[model samples]
Target chain A: MVLEATLRGIRLVGDRTLRIVERIGATVAFLVMTLVHSATSFRRFDLVIREIFFAGVQSLIIILVSGLFVGMVLGLQGHETLQNYGSEQSVGVLVALSLVRELGPVVAALLFASRAGSAITAEIGLMKATEQLSAMEMMAINPIARVVAPRFWGGVISMPLLAMLFSAMGIIGGFLVAVVLIGVDDGAFWSQMQAAVDFRHDIVNGIIKSLVFGVAVSAIATFEGYEAPPTAEGVSGATTRTVVSSSLAILALDLVLTAFMLKGWN
Target chain B: MERSTLNLWVGVFVLLGFFAFLVLAFKVGNLSAGGNGTTYTLIAHFDNIGQLKERAPVRSAGVLVGRVKSVRFDPVHYNAEVQMAIDTKFPFPKDTSASVLTSGILGEQYIGLDAGGDEKMLKDGDEIKLVQGAVVLERLIGQFLFNKAQDSGADKGAQK
Candidate 1:
C-alpha cells in the first residue's frame, strides 16, 4: 500500500509539472500573438508612449554613466597595453570597435533587463496573484494586449536607444581618457578614428543587436509574468525567472550575432 | 492623462537625443560617406599582405588622402594586389613609394605613401613601385625571443 501511494504521488506531481509547462508555453504563444496584434492597435498610443518613456528616456542617465565608465576603463587599459608596444594611435579603433561590437548592446541589454525585467515580472505576477487578470477577462478586455503589449513595445524601443546613448557616451569617455589621462593628441585621436572606423556596418550592427535584445527581454519578462502561479512564492519565482532568463538570452543572442558579424575576419 | 503626456514628451526628447548623437558622431568622427568623393586608384603589389583589410586608410605624411578600396591576390604574379583611392585634390607623383605601416605596436596595418621626387603625377590607374612591406609582427616577436635566449645562453656561459 505504501509503495502504491508513493507511486501515485509521483505520478500526480509529474502531471502537475507537465500542466505548468503547458501553461507557460501557451502563455508565450499568447504573448507573441498579442504583440503581433498590437501593430494594428492604434488606440494603444498612450500605452506605447508611456512604455517608450519609462524604458528609454528615464533609463538614459544610468546608461550614460555606466557607458562612460566602461569606455574610460577600456581606454585606460588599452592605452597602457598599446603604449607598452608604442602603438597609441590604434586606441581609437579599439574603443570604437569594442563599443560598437560588444559593449554597447550587451551593457544596455543587461541594464534594461535588470531594471525593467524584474519590475515587469513582479507587476504581472502580482496582477495574477490578486485575480486582476481574471477581472480583466470578465470585463471583456485582453490582458495581454492591455498590459503586456505596452511593456513589450516599450522594451523593444528603449533597448536600441539606450545602446546608441551608451556608444556615444563611451566614445566621449574614451576620448577624454586618451586626451587628458594618456596625453594622446586630440587631432591624432580624431584623425586616426576617422580613417580607421567605418560607421555603416558597425553602428548598424549594434542597433540591430539592441533591437533583438529588446524583443528577447520583453518576451521573456512577459512570459514569466503571465505564467506565475497564484501565490506569493510564485510571484517571486517569476521575477527571478524573468531576470535570469532575459540576461541569459541576451548573452546567447550576442554570441550568435558576434559570430555572424565576425565570420570573414579570421 | 498627465502621465501619458509626460511620456510623449519623453519619447520626443529621446528621439531628438538619438538623432543629435548620430549627427555628432558623423561630424566629430569625420566619417566619410563611402564612395561619395572623387577617387583615384593606386595599386600596390605585396608578397605578404598581413592584417590588411579593405577600406583601410592610405596615408601621406600621416594625413589620410585615400583608403584601400580592395585587396586581392594575383595568382599569376603570386603577389597580393591592394587597390587604393586617393583624393582628387592630392595627385600622387609617379615616384611615390607605398609602404605598409602598422599604427602602433599592436594595431591594424595601413598603407603609407612616401611622395617621390617626380614632376610627373600618377594618372587614374597607376601602380606604385618600391613597396616596403608590412612589419611582420610574428617575425619581430621571434627575433625578440631569439635575442633573449642568446642573452641567457651568454650569461650562463660567463657564469660557468
Candidate 2:
C-alpha cells in the first residue's frame, strides 16, 4: 500500500509540473500574438507614445541616481586596486570599460524592471481585476492591442535610451571620483578611456543587451498581469512576481548575451 | 500632457539620447565621424610588433600627431609593416626615426617619432627607414634570468 501511495504522489507531481510548463508556453504564444497584432495596427499610435512617457520618462530619475552611485563605487574600488600597481591613471579606462561593457546595461535593466515593470504589471492587473479587460472584450475590441501592446513597445524603445543615459551619467560619476577625488590627471583619464573603449564592440553590444532585456522584462510583466487570477490577492501576487521574475530574467539574459557578444573581445 | 507637449518632450528625449550616443562613440570610443582631415600615410617596418595594435597613437615630442592606420606582415621582408596616418598639420622630416614605446609598466604600445634635422618633409606613401620594434617584457625577463644563471655558473666554476 505504501509503495502504491508513493507512485501516486510521484505521478501527481509530474502532472503538476507538465501543467505549469504548458501554461508558460501558452503565455509566450499569446505575448507573441499581441506583439504582432500591435505592430500591424499602427493607427492608435498615441497610446504607444503615452506609454513611452509613462514607462520611459517616468523612470529616468531613479536610473540616473543608481547609475551615478554605482559608477562612483566602481571608481573608488578601481582606484584602490590600481594604485597598488602604480597604474592608477588608467582608472578612467577601467571605469568606462566596466560601465559601458557590463554594469551599465545590466544594472540599468534591473532597475528598470523593478521600477517601471512593477508599475506596468500593477496597472494591467488592476484593469483585469476591475473587469475593464472583460468589458473591452465584451465590446468586441482586442485588449492586447489597446492595452498590452503600447506598454510593451514603450518598454522596448525606452530601454536603450535609458541604458545610454545611465552609462553617460556613470562616466561622469567615475570622472568625479577618479579625477577630482583621487587626483588622477584629467588628461590621462580622458585620453586613456578614449583610446581603449571601442564604439562598435563595447557601446553597441551594451545597447543590444539592454534592448533584449527590455523586451523580456516587459513581456513577463504584461503576461503575468494579463493572466493573473481576477482577484485582489491575485493582482498583488502578479506584481510581486513581475518584480522578482523580471529581475531574474534580466540577470540570466545578461549572462547569455554577454557570453555571445563578448567573445573574442579580450 | 497635451499631444504637442508630449511630442516635444519625446523629441527632446530622443535628441538627448542620440547626443549621448554620439559622445560615447566619438569622445570615449575615439571614433570620429568627420572625414580624416588632410592626412598623409607613412609606412614603417618593424622586426616584431609585440602588443602593438591598429589605432595606436603615434606621438612626436610627447604630443599625438597621428594613429596607426593598419598593420600587416610583409612575407618577403619577413617583417611587420605598419601604416600610420599623420596629420598634415604636424608633418615631420623624411628622416624621422620611429620607435615603439610603452606608456607605463603594464600599458599599451605606441609609436614615438624623433624628428631629424631634414629640410624636406615626409610625403604620402613614404616609408620611414629607421624603425625600432616593440620591447617585449617577457623576452627581457627571460634574458635577465639567463644572464643571472650564466653568472652563477661562472662563479661556481671559478671556485672549483
Candidate 3:
C-alpha cells in the first residue's frame, strides 16, 4: 500500500507539471490571437480610448503616491549611506539612475499588475461567468476584437507613460528630501546627475522595459479571463492566477532585458 | 462617465506623460546640452590611453567642446587611435594639442584640447599632430621608488 501511495504522489506531481506547460502554451497562442484582433480596434478607436481611461487614468493616484514615497525613502536611505563616504553630493545621481534604470519600470509594472491587471482579469472572468461573452458571440460580435484587443492595446499605451511619470515624480521627491531637507548642495545634486545619467542608455531602456511589461501583464490578464470556466469559482481562480503569473513574468523579463541591454555599454 | 470627460482625461494623461518625458530628457538627463547639430571629427593617436573611453568629454579651457566618438588600436603605429566629434561652433586650430587627462585624483579620463595660434580651423577628418598619452600612476610610483633606492645605495657607498 505504501508503494502504491508513493507512485500516486509521483503521478500527481507529473500531472500538475503537464498542466502548467499546457497553460503556458495556451497563453502564447492567446497572445498572438489578441495581437491579430487588435487591428480591428484601431478603426473603432473609442473602444481603446475607454479602456485607456479605465486602466490608465483610474490607476493614476496609487502610482503617483507610491512613486513619491519610494523616492523619499531612496533619498533618506541614500543620504544615510553616501554621507558616510563623504559623497552625499552623488545622492541625486544615485536616486535618478536607480529610479530611471530599474525602480521606475519595475515597481510601476508590479503595481500595474496587481491593480489594472487583476481588474482586467476579473472583469472578463465575470463576463464569461455570466455568459456575456457567449451572448456577444451569438450576436455575431467578435468578442476578442470588440472587447479583449482594446484592453490589451490600452495597457500597452499606458504602462510606459505611467512608468515615466513615476520616475519623474520620484526624481522630484528625491530632490526635495536630499537637497531641501538633508542640506546637500543643490548644484552638485543636479550637475552630477546630468553628467552621469545617459539619456539613450538609461531612459530609453526604461521605456522599452515598461512597454514589454505592459504586453505581458495585459496578455496574461486577458488570456486568463478568456480561458476561465463559466463559473464564479473559476473566474476567481483565474483572477488570482493573473496576478501571480504576471508578477513572475515581469521580474523574469526584466532580468533578461537588463542583461541584453547592458551588452551595449562596453 | 460623460463622453467628453473621458476623452479629456485620456488627453490629459497622454499630455502629462509626454511632459514628464521632456522633463526627464531635458532637465534630468542632459538632452538639451547633448551632442546635436553640426560636428567635425578629429583624430589623435596616443601611446597609452589608460582608462579613456568613448563619449568621454573633450574639454578646451575646462569647458566641454566636444566628445570622444570612437577609440581603436592602431596596429600600424602600435598605439591607440581616438576619434573626437568637436562641435562646429568651437573650432580649434589645426596645430592644437590633445592630452589625456583625469579629474579629482581617480576620476574618469578625458581629452584636454589646448588650442594654438594657427589661422586655419581644424577641418573634419583632420589629424591632430601633437598628442599626449594618459598618465599611468603605477609608472610614476615605480619611478619614485627606483630613485629613492638609488639614493640610499649612494649614501651607503659614501659611508663605507
Residue A74: error of model 1 in Å? 3.2
Tell me chain A's TM-score in each of the predictions.
0.87, 0.92, 0.95
Give per-residue lDDT, candidate 2, residue A205: 90
Q: Report the candidate with higher TM-score, 1 versus 2.
A: 2
By the TM-score metric, which is better: model 1 or model 3? 3
Task: List model 3 lDDT by residue over A97-164, tens digit each.
Answer: 99999999999999999999999999998998898999999999989998899999999899999999
DockQ of each: 0.25, 0.45, 0.75
For every candidate, the chain B TM-score is: 0.72, 0.78, 0.93
RMSD of each: 6.8, 4.8, 2.4
TM-score ranking, high to low: 3, 2, 1
Which residue pairs collide in model 1, if any?
A87-B104, A87-B105
lDDT of 1 at A90: 71
Q: Which ten residues in a row have the lowest lDDT in candidate 3 chain A?
A: A257-266
Q: Model 1: per-residue lDDT, tens digit, A72-141?
A: 9888988989898777877877887788778989998999898887888888889999999999999998
Candidate 2 vs candidate 3: which has greater lDDT?
3
lDDT of 2 by residue, A1-266 (tens): 99999999999999999987886686679778777878634677788878888888888889889889988998999999999988898899998999998888888888888899989988999999999999999999888988999889888888898888889888889999999988999999998898678787789999999899899888988988898888989989998988887888788888888888756445
Writing each residue's lDDT as its tens digit, candidate 2 over B7-126 gives: 777777767778778878887776662224567999999999888998788889988788899999999999999999988888889899999999877777899999999999999999
Q: Highest DockQ among the candidates is held by which one?
A: 3
